[model samples]
Target: MRQLIFFGWNFIFNADVSPLRHIPDTKRRHLVLQALGLMWAVSFGIALGSYTVLAISVLGHAVLIAAAAVTVATYTAAASKPHLFMSGLGRSRDGEHD
Candidate 1:
């Protein structure tokens, strides 16, 4: 949660600073979220294996899959165009249209 908050803050504040910043922050956040999702999948998969119960572990795995899917889609989308996510960090050129 804390890591997510930090990522959000960076996204909100630093996104417009540069294309490089946009690429790294987007990629890093995706990676972090992916790791967390993997942790959930593995932990619950193991729990389900040992107990033969299909409830808690199933819920956990579903959550994991959902998180991973969302992040992957988001990152892929962001990888295109990019200026959408890099909305604020640049100095405006006079009379230049974006």
Candidate 2:
């Protein structure tokens, strides 16, 4: 039990030894940090009865979800119809510069 507590403390306080380092993508790391910030915001809002903060955090979460959905849709569309999106960009269908 004591070892587990110490591990948790180290994980929270020691950035150099944290699990975030294992994530190779910078965007994913940023997303994780943003999520942690939102969790803290929600916790603070609930603890202090700040409905405004809670609303803002909820809005932020919604924005993130929307952005992710748009990104997925764009990728899917691009994959399905690469020519439609990539045309007039000085590149050919074979990815060669014109």
Candidate 3:
């Protein structure tokens, strides 16, 4: 059980061995990560009873908005300076390793 838990954790959190590694385009890979983050954040908020059929509370809305803002900011940063996010990946614009 412990091994299974550890594997799950790594599979979700470990970038070095992530499926993203196969995506040679750095921008595309980071974009995918950003999308995943946004989805996770929104899903987490929903799981915590943030959203309801009737209405959403101010705090819940604020949390979701903040998540969206962060996603946009990170996307902008990744687009302008992808090198900051490409530490161990070493992939260049032309899909060549540096």
- Candidate that would win on TM-score: 3
Ranking by TM-score: 3, 2, 1
What candidate 1 gets wrong by more than 4 Å, as runs, is 1-52, 88-98
- Model 1 alpha-carbon miss at residue 72, Å: 0.8
Candidate 2 regions with alpha-carbon error over 4 angstroms: 1-48, 89-98
Worst 10 residues of 3 by lDDT: 50-59
Give the per-residue lDDT of model 3 (tens digit) for 42-84.
Answer: 8988877645633557667889999999999999999999988
lDDT of 1 at 11: 56
| Rank by lDDT (best first) | 3, 2, 1
**Clash numbers, per candidate:** 1, 0, 0
Estimate the lDDT of model 3.
Answer: 0.80
Candidate with the larger TM-score of 2 and 3: 3
TM-score of each: 0.33, 0.39, 0.40
**Tens digits of per-residue lDDT for model 1, 1-98:** 99988777665455454233545578775566567669989998998787876666788999999999999988987898676766655765785545
**Candidate 3 to native Cα RMSD, angstroms:** 28.8
lDDT of 2 by residue, 19-97 (tens): 8768788678768867987999899878787677788999999999999999999999888988777567654767766
Better of 1 and 3 by TM-score: 3
State which candidate, 1 or 2, has the greater TM-score.
2
